[model samples]
Target chain A: MTAMSSAGHSRERHALLLMLSVLAVLAILHIQQGARPIPATVMLDAVLSPDRDAFDHFVILSLRLPRASACIVGGAAFGAAGFLLQVAMRNRLAEPHVLGLNAGASLAVVLVTTYQPVVLPDILMPFAASLGAAGLFGLVLALSALGSGRFDPVRMVFFGIALSALASALVSAILILNEDTLEQLRFWLVGDAAGGGAAAVWSILPAVALGLVAGCLLMPQLATFSLGESISVALGASVHRTRIAALVVTALLCGSAVSLVGPIGFVGLMAPALWPRLHQRPSLGAFLLVAGSGAAILLAADILALGLLAPTELPTGALTGLAGAPVFIWLVARRLT
Target chain B: MTSRSADPPTRSRLTAEALSVGHGGQAVVQDIELDIFEGCMTALLGPNGSGKSTLLAGFARLLPALGGSVRLDGSDLATFPTRHVARVLGLLPQQPPVPEGLSVFDLVARGRFPHQGFFSQWSRQDEAAVGEALALAALADLADRPVETLSGGQRQRAWIAMVLAQETPLLLLDEPTTFLDAAHQVAILDLLRDLVRRHRRTVVCVLHDLNMALQYADRLVFLKEGRIRHVLTHPSQCDGRIIEEVFEMPVVSLKHPQSGLPVFLPCASRQPEARP
Candidate 1:
C-alpha cells in the first residue's frame, strides 16, 4: 500500500509540474503572439519601465497585457468555481454556465447597462455581477430544493437550464426595448477579452481576491463533500453550511470572471475535467491543478481568438462556447454509456 | 437511566427522550426513548417500515425530530456544533453513494475530516488512524484499489474501514449487512463484534437478520409498528411468540447446542397435522 501510494504521489507531482509549465507557455503566447506582435525585449521593457511614445509599448500595455492576464486570472477563478459547484452539487455535469451563474452575471450587466438611465461605471460591474450570480444561485437552490434542503443532482441540473433560458429571455427583452445600446451589448454579451485592459481588471481585483479566498476556505469542505451527505454529516460536516459556503465561492468566482470578459464558457468544465485524466483525486491539490489548467485553456482559446482574425477579434466566449459544447456532449455521452 | 451499563468501563452514552424521528414533518418512528450504553454493541431489529434506519438517522441528527430531543453525553444534540458532534459519533448509512475512482486508503483517510480544521494540515494522527482502520477492516491488502472496483464483500469492508478511521467512541450503522450474501453477512457481523469487544468502541447498527444479531449484538432492540417490542440483553429473554408477532411469521425457539443460547428457527405457519 505504501509503495503504491508513493507512486501515485509522484505521478500527481509530475502532472502538476506539467500543468504549470503549460500554463506558463500559454501565457507567453497570449502576451507575445497577438496581431500586433511585440518582441520579447520590447514587451519586457514596456512592463519594467513604460515608454509612452513606443507604439509596441502602447499595444502591450493598453491591450494585450490585461487581456492575457484576464484570461489567466479569470480562467483560474472559473475553474475553481466550477470544481466547487460540481462537488457541492455532487453532479459531475455541474458548471457555472450550465448552472446559469455566467448567464446571471451577464443579465445583471444587461440590466445595469440598459435599464439604468445613468451608465454604470466599469468599476461596479463586478458588484452587480456578484449580486446577480448569487441571486440566481439562490433561486437555483430554491427551485431544486423542492421543499427539501437536499440538493438532488438531477433536479438541480434541470433548474439550471430553465433558469438560464429565463435569464436569456429577459436579456433579449431589454435589448429590444433599448435598441441604442445594441452594438455595445453585443460585444459584452458575446464575451470579449480585448478591451479588458489593466484599469478594468484592476477594478475587479478585490472581487477576484475575495472569490479566491472563498475557494480556498471551501476547498477542505468540498474535498469531503464527495463522501455523500450522510457520510459528510457523520464526519461532522454541517452539510447545509458547507453547501451554502461552496455556492457563495462559486458565485463570487463566476461573477468575477463575468466582470472581466463577460461569460466565457467551458473553461470551468474543461479545466477540472482534465485532472481526472491525470488520476487526480478531489483534493486541494486537484483544485489547484484545475485552476492552473483552466487558466491554460482560456489563454489558449484567447490566443486563437486574437491570432485567428487579426484586426477583427473573435469574442473569447464564442471560441470557448463553440468548442465547449462538443466536449460537454462527449462527457454526457460517456457518462451515460 | 443514568447508568452506563456493561460498556468496557468507559462512560459515553447516546440517549433519546421521547424522540419523534421522521422526514419532512411526518414522524416515522415516534416516542423513541432509549439509551445506547458506551462501548457496547446494540442492534436494532424490525420489519420493513418499522423505522430502524429513520431512528438511527434521527440519533445522528441527519433527520430532525418532530418533537423531543436527543442528548449526546448530556449535551443537547442540537446545541453541539456539527464538527463537535462528529468528534464523538460516526455513522455509516446504507449503501452510501461512493465517489468514482476513490481508493480504499483515500476513502478511509477522509474519515478524519471532523478532526481537521478548515486549514488543518494532514497530521500524523490522521495518517495513523487511517492505517489502523485499514488493518482492522483487513483492507490493507487492497488499499490502492478503487472502491468501485471492489467486490460486494470487499466494498462493505471498505465502508467499515472508513467508519473505523473516524476513531469515534460510538458508531451508528444502518443495516450494515443488508445486501451481502449469507457468508459475507456473517463476516461483517464478526467484524462488528471485533470492533466492540477488542477496540472498546460502541456500535448501534440496524440488522434484518435475527440469527446474525443473536450471534453478534450485546443487546437487541426489537421494534414493531414504530415502537420497540423488547430490549433484551440475552436471546433467551425472547421467545418464538415475540418473533412471530414482529415478523408476522411463526417460528420455533430452540437452544443452540454449543452455547445454549436461544435460536429462533422458522416453522410452518399452520400446524403441520392439518389436512391439505
Candidate 2:
C-alpha cells in the first residue's frame, strides 16, 4: 500500500511539473504576440534587467507582461471558484458563468461605471463586482432554499440560469440606452484582457489571494463532501460552515475574475471538469492543478484572441465561450447518458 | 426487564434525557429516555414510522434535539465540538453514496478527517489506522479496487471500514445489513457483534430483520409511534407480544433448535391484489 501510494505521489508530481511547464510556455507565447512581434530573448532581457529606453522593453514590461499576468491570475481565480462551486453544489456544470456570478459582477460593474455621475476609482470595480456576485449568489441560495428549505443542486442551477438571463437583459438594456458607455464597455462586455493591463490586475490580486487561501483551508473538509451529506457530517466535518466558506471563497474569486477581465466564461467549467483526467480524483493537489489548468486555458485563449485575426484582436470571452459550449454539451450528454 | 436475573453490569456510553427529535418542527421521536451501554451491540427494532432511524440519527448528533439533550460521557452531546464527537462516535447511514473511481483505501482514509489538520500532513499513524481498519473489515486485499466495482458485501464492508477507521468508541449504524444476501447479512451481523465484543466498541444500530437482531444483539430496543416500547437485555426476554405490538403483526415466538435463541415468525396477512 505504501509503495503504491508513493508511486501515485510521484505521478502527481510529474503531472504538476508538466502542467506548470505548459503554463510557463503559454505565458511566454502570450507575451510574445503583438503587432510588432518581439523575440523571446529580447523579452527575457527586458524582464530580467532595466532597459527603460527601448520601446520593445517598455511594451514588454508595461503592456504584455501585465496582460498575461491578468489572464493567468483571473483564470486561476475562476478555476478555483468553479471547483468550489461544483463541489458545494455537487454539479459538474456549476461555474461562475452558469451560476449568475459573472453576470452579477458584470451588472454591478456596469451600474457603477456607466450610471454614476461621479468618476469612481478603478480599485472599486472589484469591490462592486464582489458585492454584486455575493448578493446575487445569496439571492440564488435563498430562492433555491424556498421550496425545499435546502440548497437543491438542480433548483439552484435553474434559478441561476434564470437570474443570469434577467441580469444579462438588464445589462443590455442599460448599455443600449447609454451609447457613450457602450463603446467604452464594448470590449469589456465581451471579456477582453486589454483593459486589465496592470492596475486592474493589482486591484483584484489581494482578493484572489485571500480566496485561494480560504479554499486551501476548506479543501480537506470539502473533499469529504463527496461522501454525501450524512457521511460528511458523521466524519466530523462541519458541513454548514464548510459550505458557507466555499461560497464566500467562490464569490471572492468570481468577483475578482469578473472585475479583472469582464465576465470570461468556460475557464471555470473546463478547468475543474478536466481535472480528473490529470488526477484520479479531487484532492488538495488537484485543487492547485485545477487552478493552474484554468490559468493555462485562459492564457491560451487570450493568446488566440491577440493573434487569431492578426492586428484585429478578438474578444477572449467569445473564444472561450465558443470553445466551452461544446465541452459543456459533452458534459451534459455524458452525465445524462 | 423480564430477564434482569442474568444481566451483566455495564456502563452507559450514551444517555438520552427527555430527547425530542423531529423534522421541520414536527416531532417524530418525542421525549425519549434511553441508555446505550458500552461494549455491547444494541439493535433498534421498530416498524416503519416508529422513529428508529430518527433515534439513531439523534444519538449520532445528525439531528438536533427538539427539547432535551443527549449526554455522551455525562456531558451534553451537543456541547462537544462536532469534530470531537466524530472522533468518539462514528455513524454509517443506509446508502452511503460512494463517489465514482474512489478506491477502497482512499475512502477508508477519509475516515481520518477529524484527526487531521489543514497543514498537518497525512502521517504514519493515519496510514496504520487505515490499514488496520481495512484488515479488520477484510478489505486489505481489495484496497486498490474502486468501491463501485466491489460486490455488495465488499462495498458494505468498505463503508463499515470507513467508519471503523474513524476509531470511534461508539458506532451508530442504520440498517447495515439491508439489501444483502443471507450470507452477507450474517457476515455483517457477526462483524458488528465482534466489534462490540472483541474491540470493546459500543454499537447502536437499527435493524429490520427481527431474527437477525434477536440472534446477534446483546440488547434489543423496540420503538413504536415516536416512543420506545421496550428495552430487552436478553434475547430470552424478547416475547412475541412486544414484537407483535411494535410491528402490528401477529407473530409466533420459537426457540432456535441449535442455538436456543428466540425467533419470531410473522403470521401472513392479506394477499397481494390479483395481477393481470
Candidate 3:
C-alpha cells in the first residue's frame, strides 16, 4: 500500500509539473506571436534587455503581458469559484454564468456606463461588478431557501436561471436606453482584455488572493459536504457554516473575475464538469485541476482570438461563448443519454 | 445508572432523559428516558412513523430536543462544542448520497477533520484511523476505488467505514441494513457486535427486523406512536405482550435454537378479507 501510494503521488506530481510547463510555453508563444509578429529570439532579447526598442517593449510589456495575466487570473478565479459552488450545492450545473453571477455583473456595468458614466472611473468597474455578482448570489440563495425547506440543488439552479434572465433583461433595457453607451458596453459586455491597465489588475488582486485562501480552507469540508448534510454533520462538519463560507468564497472569486474580464462564461462550469472524469480523487486535486485547466483554456481562446483575426481583434469572450455552446450541448446530450 | 459509575474501567455511556424530539414546532417523540450502556449493542425497534429515526437523530445531536436533555458522561449534550461532541458520538443516516468520483480512502479520511487544526490538515493518526476503518469494513483492498463504482453492499460498507474512522466512543446508525441482502445484513450486524464487544464502543441502531434485533441487541428499545412502550435489557426480559401491544399484532416468543435468545414470530389474523 505504501509503495503504491508513493508511486501514485509521484505520478500526480509529474502530471501537475507537465501541465504547468505547457501553460508556460503557451504563454510564451502568445507573447511572441501577435499582429506584428516578433521572433522568439527577439522577444527573449527584449524581455532580458532594458534598452530594447520602444515598440518591442510596448508590445511585450504593455499589451501582451497584461492580456496574458488577465486571462490567467480571470480563468483561475472562475474555475475556483465554479468548483466551490458545485461542491457546496452538490450540483454539476452550479457555475457563475449559469447561476446569473456573470449576468448580474454585466448588468451593473451596463447601468454604470449608461447612467453614471461620467462619475464612475475605470478602476471602480470590477468592484461594481463584484457587488452585482454578490447581490445576485445572495438573491438566488434567498429565493431558493424560500421555495424549499432545505437547500435543494434543483431549486437553486432554477432560481439562478430565473435571476440570470432578469439580469439579462435589465442589461438589454439599459443598452436600449442609452444608444451612445452601446458601443462601449458592447465591447465590455462581450468580455474583452483590450483595455485593462495596471490599476485595474491591481484593484482585483486583493479579492483574488482572499478568495483563493478561503477556497483552500473550505476544500476539505467540501468533501464532507458532498456526502450530504446528515453525513457531513455526523462527521463533525457544521453543514450550514461550511456551505455559507463556500458560497462567500465563490462569490468573491466569481465577482472579481467578472469585474476583471467582462462575464467570461463556460470556463467555470465546463472545467468542473470535465475535471472529475479526468482524475481519480475528485476532491481537492480536482478543484485545482479545474482552475488550472480553465486558465489554460481561456489563454488558448485569447490566443485564437488574437491570431485568427489579426487586425480585426475579436473579443475573447465572444470566442469563448462560441466555442463553449457546442460543448454545453454535448454535455447536456451526455447527461440525457 | 448504577452500572455507569461501577464501570469506571470501561467506556463512557450515552443516556437520554425525558427527551422530546420534534421538527419546526411539531413534536414527534415525547418524554423518553433511555440509557445505552457501555460496550453494548442497543437497537431501537419500531414500525414506520414510530419516531425511531427521530429518537436516534436526537441522540446524535442532529435534531434539537423539544423537551428534556441528552447527557454524555453525565454532562449536558448541548453544552459541548459541536466538534467535541462529534469526537465522542458519530451518526450515519440511511442511504446518504456519495459524492461523484470520490475514492473510498478520501471519503474515510474526512472523518478525521474534527480532530485536526487548520495547519494540521493530515497526520499519522488520520492515516491510521482511515486504514483501520477500511480493514474493519473489509474495504482495505478497494481503498482507492471510486465509491460510485462499488456494489450496494460495498458502498454501504464504505459509509460504515467512514463512520468508524471517526473513532467515536458511541455510534448511531439509522437503518444501516436497508439495501443489503440477508448475508450482508448478518455480516454487518456481526461486525457491529464485534466493534461493541472488542473495542468497547456503544452502538445504537434502528432496525426493522425484530428477530435480528432480538438476537444481536444487548437491549431492545421498543417505541410506538412516538412513545417508549418498553425497554428490555435482555432477550429473557422481552415479553410477547409488549411486542404485541407495540406492533399491533399477536406474536409467539420462542428461544432461538442456536443462541438461546428470544425470537418473535408474528401470527396472521384470521379475518376472511385479510386472506388471499
Candidate 4:
C-alpha cells in the first residue's frame, strides 16, 4: 500500500509539473505573439524588471500582461466551475455554456448595456452578470423540481438547455432592435480580452477567488456527492447544502468568467473532459489539476486566436466553440448513451 | 397461518409503527408495523406492488412516512440529524449508480464519510475501516478494480463493502440480490447471514426469491397490499396457505432433500371444471 500510494503521489506530482510547464510556455507565448511582436529577450526583461522608457516594456506591461491574465483567470474559473457543476449535478454535460449560465450572464450584460439609464463603466459589468447567473440558476432549480421533489440530474440539464435557448433568443432580439448597442458590443459580445483587459481582470478577481476558495473547501463533500443522491444521503451528507453551495460557487465563478471574457465557450466542458479519470476518484489535488487544465487550455486557445490572425484578432469565444463542439458531441455520445 | 403478538420485544433496533409511506401524495405502503431485531437477518418477501421496497425505504428514512412514524432504538427517527443516524445505520439502495471509473476501494472508502470531518478527511482509522470492509466483502483482491469492470456479483459485493465501511450495526438493503443468478444469489445470501451471525449486524433485506429467503433468513416478514400479512421466526413455521392467499396463486411446500427445510414453490392455477 505504501509503495503504491507513493507511486501514485509521484505520478500526480509529475503531471502537475508538466501542466505548470505548459501554462508557463503558453503565458510567455501569449505575451510575445500580439500585433507587433516583442523579441524573447525583451519580453523576459520586461517581465523581470520593466524599464519605464522602453516601448517594448510599455507594450508588454500595458497590453499583453492583462490579456494573458484574463485568459488564465477566466480559464481557471471556468475549469473549477465546470468541475464543481458536474459534481453537484452528477452529470458529465453540466458546464456553464451548456447549462445556460454563460448565456444568462451574457443576457444580463446586454440588458445592462442597452437599458441602464446611465452608461455604467465596464468595471461594474461582471456584477450584473453574476446577478443574472444566480437568478437564472434559481429558475432552473425551480423548474427541475416540477415533477419529483428531488433534484433529478437529467431534468435539471434539460431545463438549463431550455433556459439557454430562451436567453439566447432574447439576447438576439435585443441586439437586433438596438443597432447602436450592437456595434458597441460587436467585439466584446464575442468574448475578447483586448479592450478592457486590465480592468476586467481586476474587476472579476475577488468573486473568482471567493468562488475557487469555496470550491476547494467543498471538495470533500462534493466527492461524496458524486456517488449519487441516495447513497450520499445515506452516508449522512446533507445533499441540499452541498448542492446549493456548489451551484453558488459555479455561478460566481462562471458569471465572473463570462463578464471578463464575454462568455468564452467550452473551457468548462473541456476542463472536466481533460481530467475524466480524476473525476471518477475525486481528490483536492485532482480538482486543482482540472482547474489547471482549464487555465492552460484557455491560455493556449487565446494565444492561438491572437497568433493565427496576427493583427486581425479572432474572438476567444469563437475559437473555444470551434474546439469544444466536438468534445460536447463526444461526451453526449459516450456518457449519455 | 399462525397468529402471534403484533408488537415484538422493546429491544428492537429499528421499528416502524403505523408507518404510511408513499410517493407524490399517495401512500404505497400503509400502516406498516414491524420490528427489526438485533443480530438477525430479516427478509421481506412479497409479490410485485406488495410495498416491500417502500417499507424498506420508510425504515431507511429515504422516504417520508405519510402518516405514522419510524423509530430507531425507541426514539423517533425524524428527530435525529441525518449524519448521526447514518453513523448508526447504513442503507444500500437498489442498484445505486456507480460513478465512472470508481475503484472498489474508493467506493468502500466513501462509507467512511459519516465518521470523518472537514479537516480530518482521511485518517488511519478510515483506511483501516475501508481495508476491513474490502476483506469482509471478500473483495480484497479486486479492491483496485473499477466497479464498472467488476462482474455483477462482484459489483454488488463492492457496494455492500461500501456500506460495510460505515461500520453501522444495522443495515437496510433494498433487493441486494436482484439481477444475480441462483448461485450468486445464494452466495450473497450466505454473506448476509454471516454478517448477522459473525458480525452481529442486524440486516433487513427485501428478497423476491422465497426459497432463498427460506433457506437463509432467520426471520421473514410477509407483506401484502401494504400490510404485514404475517411474520415468522423459522421457515418450518411458514405454510403454503399464507403464500397462496397473499400472492393469489397456488403453491406447494416441499422439504429440501439435504437440509429438510420447507421451500415454497409456486404451483399452476387450478382449472375450473367443465360446464357439464
Candidate 1 chain A minimal-lDDT segment of 10 residues: A276-285
TM-scores, one per candidate: 0.93, 0.95, 0.92, 0.91
Q: Which ten residues in a row have the lowest lDDT in candidate 2 chain A?
A: A275-284
* lDDT for predicted candidate 3 compared with the true structure: 0.79
- Model 2 chain B is weakest, by summed lDDT over 10 consecutive residues, at B1-10
Better of 2 and 3 by TM-score: 2
lDDT per model, in order?
A: 0.82, 0.87, 0.79, 0.84
* Pairs of residues at least 3 apart in sequence or in different chains that clash in candidate 4: none
lDDT of 2: 0.87
lDDT tens digits by residue: candidate 1, A1-337:
4565566667778888999999888877788986665778887899899999989988888888888888888888888888878778777788889878988998887888777756677777887887898898788878898787767766877898899899989988889888976766777677887655788778887887787777767777776678777888888877778788888888888898887888788888888777763222566667778888888888988888887888777888888888889888888898889
The candidate with the higher TM-score, 1 or 4, is 1
Sorted into a CAPRI-style docking class, model 3 comes out as: medium
After TM-score superposition, what is the CA distance of residue B23 in candidate 2 from its true location, in Å?
0.8
Candidate 4 is graded, for docking, as medium
Better of 1 and 3 by DockQ: 3
Q: On lDDT, who's better, 3 or 4?
A: 4
TM-score of 1: 0.93
- Per-residue lDDT tens digits for candidate 2, residues B65-88, read 987999999999999999999999
Minimum summed lDDT over a 10-residue window in model 4 chain B is located at B1-10
Q: What's the i-RMS of each model? A: 2.4, 1.8, 2.6, 1.8
Task: List DockQ for all candidates.
Answer: 0.56, 0.63, 0.57, 0.55
User: Which of candidates 1 and 2 is the stronger one according to TM-score?
Assistant: 2
